[model samples]
Target: MESVRTCVGCRARAPRAALVRVVAIDSQVVLDERGSMPGRGAWVHRTHECVDAAIRRRAFGRALRVSGSLDTQTLQNHFQRNG
Candidate 1:
């Protein structure tokens, strides 16, 4: 069965494949492109708007259950480059 995940940015529920998986490692938020990262994962829509919303509202940290801010440059670039 396909899994459902909620987007941290938009709070919309969707199929796992429709969103990008992110995880915190070494205080850095990285995209789990292959969805194989061994840690808690957060889901976000594959769009700049959704990513910006998540960053603007600091949802990544909360969704990932991390303290303090996370560097989302890499994440932004990843989406923007491919968006």
Candidate 2:
């Protein structure tokens, strides 16, 4: 069976393949396209609404267990380009 995860943004359960995995690296929020990044991960939908909600609610830091602000510019750029 396919794995399932919850979207931090929408707080909805979805198939793992339908969500993008995000990891914290050096206080930066990076998208793990391959889902193989070495760290704790938070899942979020690729949609702008979801991404925005995640950021607005400050879910990344809480989900990833980080203690500071994280830079999500790269993640936003990625969605903007691919969206």
Q: What C-alpha lDDT does candidate 1 achieve relative to the native structure?
A: 0.93
Name the lDDT value of residue 17 in candidate 1.
Answer: 91
TM value for model 1:
0.94
lDDT (10s digit) by residue, model 2, range 14-61: 999999999999999999999999989999998988988999999999
Worst 10 residues of 1 by lDDT: 74-83
Give the Å error, residue 64, model 2. Answer: 0.4
- State the lDDT of candidate 1 residue by residue for 1-83, as single tens digits: 99999999999999999998999998899999999999999999899999999999999999899998799999999888998
Winning candidate number (lDDT) = 2
* TM-score of every model versus the real structure: 0.94, 0.96
Superposed model 1: Cα runs more than 4 Å off: none
Residue pairs in clash, model 2: none
